[model samples]
Target chain A: MAVATQDTAIRTGRFARALIYLVLLLFVLFYMLPLYVMLVNSVKPLSEITGGGMMALPQVWTLEPWAKAWSTAQIGVQPTGLRPYFWNSISMVVPAVAISTVLGALNGYVLTKWRFRGDTILFGLMLFACFIPFQIVLIPMAAVLGFLGLSGSTAGLVLVHVVYGVGFSTLYFRNYYAVFPTELVRAAQIDGAGFFQIFWRILVPSSGPIAVVCIIWQFTNIWNDFLFGASFASGDGAPMTVALNNLVQSSTGVKEYNVHFAGAILAALPTLLVYIVAGRYFVRGLMAGSVKG
Target chain B: MAANATPDFRTRLQTWLPKLVLSPSLAMVLVFVYGFIGFTVYVSFTNSRILPFVGPDGQPTHDLIGFTNYAKLFSLSHWEISLTNMAIFAGLYIVICTLIGLILAILLDQKIRGEGFLRPLYLYPMALSFIVTGTAWKWFLDPGIGLENIMQTWGWESFSFDWIKNRDFAIYTIVLAAVWQTSGFVMAMFLAGLRGIDNEILKAAQMDGASNWNLYRRIIIPQLRPAFLSAFVILAHLAIKTFDLVIAMTGGGPGRATELPATFMYSYTFSRNQMGIGASSAVIMLMTIAAIMIPYLYAELREKK
Candidate 1:
């Protein structure tokens, strides 16, 4: 009886495992379907795509759309080419991300190290700031920027993003610093280190996970930003999304389906490249929350 | 775990100076974040339009019209449609995303294989801006050139999946993409919550001969309330302000079918040059968001306390 029961349990386990794996496999397939379609259609000739099914693999894989997407489709008649826009995005985003992260780190450092008067009240104010959306600020900011001589410029956009980005970044770094032990700071202090020195040397060493979160979050936020890039910064300084918007909206008469997809691929390249290179770190960072220690 | 043992005001002050050094961030938060909204409220009531009609000395643009724009906002036909669509979109997006996230999180917690790869795959959509995702979705949904066309070519000429162009069902497409984009964060949050649960409780449940479903229903779901609330709040917030996806996917087209308040505000403010009308619309939307969010935020604070 014991032998029979053992055999039955083993068989049941195998069966359940098989079923679970099958379900997971299907789920994976479901998740990848759109990406798969994008890739397959991207490679296929325009005629073939318009003539064929999206799910089917490309019979004659061509790099034509990618080439077109990267080069000509990027420039168009608008004269705002991909390279310049790419530069604009990078320039604006790098500073925005860096400034926000630096301030966040400093804020985190101060919040953690300092037991100050009105510190918790300040922290509460920061929390309150996060709940309010930026849409309300759009008109006021535009007017302010225009009045302050920052209208239709990259600097204006940077300020806008920084204003928006600070709330989340501070929360992230503050919560992260909260999880780190005060003993570390105390030890650094016992060794006669000042606040800046301690943060630069001691606190930063263990900030790998949190920094990755900051970089990824900041990168994604600034890169994919449509509203800010559209409103504050446009013309030659327009980011890829602006180009994308123009591209999709510009095609006259019968729509150029291939070109639209191509433009989109160009616009999406930055974040996609980030994921490809630092995907693991990105997920791990987010999953780990803002804390590193 | 470490707390200051002594009440040393000098040491505290010494430590506190670093925080003061970081006050510039607070300045930005104060002026742009809090103050800008105050400015928005002031503008919403006034008769500001296009350039905001500032005085010659650059003194102020507070030409108060006493809610004329607000009155005009309610009399419009699309306002009702926009509100209804926003309510529906918020409801559907939150419910669907939360449900999928919870299920995915639970499934992941079952010790499934290939979790590392699969987890990121689920999350990749979140990293890309909605512009990219929306662009991809549009291509996939376009009637003549996308999935439906492809579907028809494959020996089903009569088969139709034409929701993308239909004014009525186009909003659902936005929901689908939004869900795809946000579900991963939900899953991760729930996964964190699940990991926080005591393993002993699960073992005890198993010892008591509880079924898998029973264990999840009674033991797991109860513990995941915090994660659920977090997911729900985030989704609800995103839903009310969903602009990029609608703009990229459908452009609030097919006669304003996919129009939410954000898109509506963008069109009126930027495209049509009616800053007063747009600002008024946005102000109302802000109030609505605040109405939902303040209670939720208070409840969350209470729970945290």
Candidate 2:
């Protein structure tokens, strides 16, 4: 009986180990396959790419496509090219995230520590704000943008993204604050620390995780944003997203796969770099944003 | 602390200062977000065409034609197709991403070397723009100059994968791209949940000689419900609102087979200049999300212990 039981135990251990390996191998393939295909095809000459299998290594790799994508695809001869839009994306997103996150911190501070008149109602309304789809606001937003003389500026796009972006950011900050012991706030108040004082000195400093979360969420939402960018900006004020559309979709022209791949790669570089550098914090940020809510 | 204490003027002002700081965000919430939604719903009821007109012109203008715009919306084949496409995309996207995410999460949850690197590989897709990702997918999925040609050259005479052009299967390509981009994030949710599970419970089950399947089915799955719920809700919301994936991958192409509500509204408002119809569609989209969400929220909130 002892011998049989020991044998079965050994078998189960081997099976479990094998199963784990198989699952991991399959998942990695699933995750990496498309990316591998993209990278392999991007470097290969059209002949090699089309004539060879997607999984095959590039036989005759060339850098010409990347150069063409940068110099010609959306980078026009007229000077106002992808560079302007690249800057536009950077300027709009950075400031929008900054402004929205700061305000979100303030809202979270107020909601958690300072109980004001109709405070619960205010919090409810803020919660309600997050759920509403932004499409409902396009016409009115256009009208408002027009009225404010912001219809064709990068700043206008920033303003709108911040407005929409704040809801989620606030939810992040507020929910994080909820996890923090209320005694911290009560103790701070007892120590004669005011709202802004306590928030800036104590809460904000310790809120590194939530802050990272806010930055990543806001950055992605704003940078990858197409609808708001398209609606708000055109010409020089356009972001990378709009430029990408123009580069990929020329209504009356032949499609350029080489340039399109180049543009696509160029477009994804920023967020990808951010992910590589600060991915763990970003995950923590998302977890806090999602799980609590 | 005195009940109903009449606070001093300085205390009152100091207390109100944070609210003052909050005014900027409040202003945004009031005018930009909610205001536009209200205005769009109003526009939907009007007889507006081409562009949004506030009042009647000698030509057809934005007049209060009641349910006429909605009447016309239901009659359009384009509208029906777009709605059908959205439903299909959302359903497939939510289900596939969750299933893949969960399966991957479980594998990574096991004690394994190199699991850390794999976690980032899965999550990296979440960081990319759909437009960029879409471009990559298109090239890889292209017939002559991409995967298919490459495959043909490798001596596989019968290897055809061209869903990008096939109207029926075009949207599935979009779903595949999206799942690639988003499943990793859901996997992170499950990873975090798995980390939080008490190790002692697993050891106790092991002592009881419980099989792995029994341990997972009876103990672990139930413990991970919150994590699953959160991941599912976020993924479901994203799927319903998917427009970037479609535009980036197929552009609702091969005959508008991949049209989503957001993209459809965009075309109506900008391309077709049918603001009335566009506004009407936006209202419907908003209401549909709200309808689905409120019930989910109620159920979850009520169930909270």
Candidate 3:
């Protein structure tokens, strides 16, 4: 009787474990469902997509949709495709990301290594800035941009992003440097090294990991930003997101679902590539931002 | 000897250098962040409309109209619909994300196989922007060419899944898409919290013959309060700032069925040319975000103190 009861307990435990696995797999399917739909639909031609079915893989796959999405898709009266806007995003994001990360690093160095009075309060204020809904600042920001003669300019968008992105990058680097070793700075000080000198030689050499985290975070945020892009930039200055939205929204001719899907994927590819390559740092950045806050 | 000597000019520069390097960021925050907020609040109370009226002297001007914009915002049916939709979206997003995330975290905590693959799979959506998520879901949810059409083709003959088009069900589609993008992030948080829990405590509970359910319910779950709170605050802010998703997916759509406050604010301020009303609505969003953020910030910062 004892043996039989133990046997049943083991079997039940196996069954329960199997149930957990099944549920997890189900969720994985559900999460991947939309992506799968996107991939399959993007490859199939418009004929197969409309005449056949949504889920069926194309009997003959084609990259035409991607080509169209990249070069021929129209938005409003402009048919310049997403290529120019893609470059616009690139130009806008690169400067913004580089500037923001540099500022964040410098800010982090000061906030952590050289503690001053009211620093924490100042940090608290910056963190508060990070979460304020951008809506509150939109109208005034437009006014400021116009006042500065930068309305609808890419350079203006870059300035806006860098300003807002500083809070996050600072938060990231500060948290990182808070736990960083301070003995290096002291030793450098003993060697008669100044602030920027010590930072360039000692701190920056070891900032590889955190810098990776900062750059990736800043890149993703600035690249994927639609609110600022939509509000601040337009016409020749519109980023890929705004252009993509206009493309999807404007349907003067036959609705090209294939091109739409391809465009969506193209827009997503940059951040996706970052996540794939350096996901560990990405998660680290996220946890630091979320958990610490 | 050097320490005892009078401080040199270079040393004094060192003392002030950090402040100088930090001043630019601080000043930017002051002018762009707080100053803009002040300006917005001022705009919210004015009679500014499509454009700020210019006075006879040629400078732009507006009469101080106390709470008139706010009153107009509250009375508008579109604003009311946006608020109602936000309430629904936020409520559902928080509750559903918490539950699903908790479950996924617990399941992953069991030391399952292929966690490496599954964790990233769960997290990849977070890498995509709301525009991508919205468009992807729009394709998958479109009645003619999406899941319903595919389902009908699969010989079910009656597999109806047209929530994206239905007015009563459209808001839920936003919930579904938002949850898909963020639940993985919530799961990651809970998973971290789970990992932080003391394993010896669990061992002790097991030694006391506690069931698995009791172990989670009585001990593990309580310890996850911080994670829960963080998730709630983050998700609440995301829900409040949910413009891109709504705009990308439904465009406040099929006649304001899925209108959110962020979308409402944008359309009113820029598109609909109701800048004052939009600014008022924007102020309301700020308050909502502040309601959740201020206390959370206080608690976190205070804990350090």
Candidate 4:
């Protein structure tokens, strides 16, 4: 009787475990459904889509949509495709990410190691700046860009991103360095090392992980930004997101769903690539960004 | 004595160097964030519309007209619709994301197999831009050449899922797309929270013959309060700042059914040239965000010290 009861309990436990796995699998399907749909239909001809075969595998796979989206699609009366705008985003994101990360490293260095009166308060102010709605600054920012003669320019977008992005980067580095040992800095200082030397030789060498996190976060943000792009840049200077929006939303077109999907995937490729390559850091960045030190 | 003087000077420079390095960022924040906010606030109080009111001296002017723009903003039907849509969208989005996040986090914590593969699959959407997510879903949800068509072709005749086109239900489609994009992020947050929980307590509860349901309800769920709070604040803010997705998916369309404050502010300020009213609307958004953010930041900072 004891053995039979134990056997029955084991059987029930297996049944429950199966149920759990089934539910998890269902969610996996739900999550993958849209991506699968996009990938499948993006390769098919327009007829397959309009013929109610959206969920079906492509009868004829072709790279034509991808090619067209890259170099020949009409966006806002320009048949320049997403090629220029892709470069626009690249130009904007690279400098923005680089400058913001460096500034954040310096700010993080000072805020944590070189503690002084009212420094926390100052850091608090910068931190609060990160969360403010951009709508509040849109008018002033537009005016400032125009006054500075950077309106509708990639350089202007870079400046806007760096200004807004420095906060989170600062937060990440500050939190990372807060736990770093100050004794090493003191030793380096006693050995007659200068400020920049100590940073470059001692701190920066060990800052590899946090730097990756900061760079990835900043890259994703500046690359994907649409509001600033739409507000500040226009015409030939629009970034990929804005251009993709125009291509997809153009009311006069034949609703080229395959081309739109291809363009979206192209727009998404950089960040998605980064996420896949360094997803662990991406999650760390996301967690660090949210949960304050 | 000269050598001693050099060391002193070096020490003084070192003390100031950190501040010197920090000053530029400080200046940028002050001017760009705070100063610009001040400028926008002033604009809201002025009579500037389309362009800044110009004085006889051939310069832009700020002729203050107290509360007129705000009064006009409050009286607009478009503004009313945007606010109503925001409340509904935010409420449903937060609740659904939280529920789904908590459930997924708990389930994933059950020592399941293939955990590594499953987690990132859930989170890839967070990595994609809202525009990309919006584009994918817009077509996926379209009645023609989309889910409805596929369902009808699959012999589910009379099937209808045209919420994307219907004004009354269009807002829910936005909610669906949003929740899909963000629920994974919330799940990550809650999962982190779950992982951080003290396993000793869980072990102790299990030793006391607690059922799994009771263990979660009585102990595990309570421990996730901070995660819950963080998720709420983040989701609330994101919901308010939702412009890209709406613009991509619906363009606040079907006659402004999904009009949100962010979109509203953009169209009014940039397109309609209602600069003063737009500034006023932005100020309202800022106030709402501040009300949530200020307290959270204060508590987080205070607790640290």
* Overall local distance difference test of candidate 1: 0.74
Candidate No. with top TM-score: 4
Clashing pairs in 2: A52-B150, A53-B150, A136-B37, A137-B36
True contacts kept of each: 0.49, 0.57, 0.71, 0.69
Question: By how many angstroms RMSD does model 4 differ from the true structure?
Answer: 4.4
**TM-score per candidate for chain A alone:** 0.84, 0.86, 0.93, 0.94
Tens digits of per-residue lDDT for model 3 on A17-102? 89989999999999999888788888989988786477888877999999999988886466777899999999999999999999
lDDT (0-100) at residue A174 of candidate 4? 92
Candidate 4 TM-score versus the reference? 0.96
Q: How accurate locally is residue B137 in candidate 2, as Cα lDDT from 0 to 100?
A: 81
**lDDT digits (tens) for residues B132-180 of candidate 3:** 8899898888988888888788887888888888898999999999999
DockQ of 3: 0.47
Over A1-293, each residue of candidate 1 has an lDDT whose tens digit, in order, gives 00010111111266776776776667677667666766667787777767755667777888787666656563545544366676788888989999888888888778767657677667656656665655788888888998889887778878878877776677677767877889988998899887778888988888877787778877877889898788777677788787677667665654555666666766777888888888865665454331121
Off by over 4 Å in 3: A1-12, B1-7, B51-57
lDDT of 2 by residue, B1-305 (tens): 45445466558978778888888887778777667777788899986765435335545455787888889888988889998987788888888888887777777766666777778888888777787787778777778666667667777779897888888898888888888889888887776777767777887888888887887789887999988788777776677678777887778888888888888888888789788888899899888877756565556434531
lDDT of 4 at B300: 87
The TM-score, computed over Cα atoms with residue i paired to residue i, of candidate 2 is: 0.90
| All candidates: interface RMSD | 7.0, 6.9, 6.8, 6.9
Query: How big an interface RMSD has model 4?
Result: 6.9
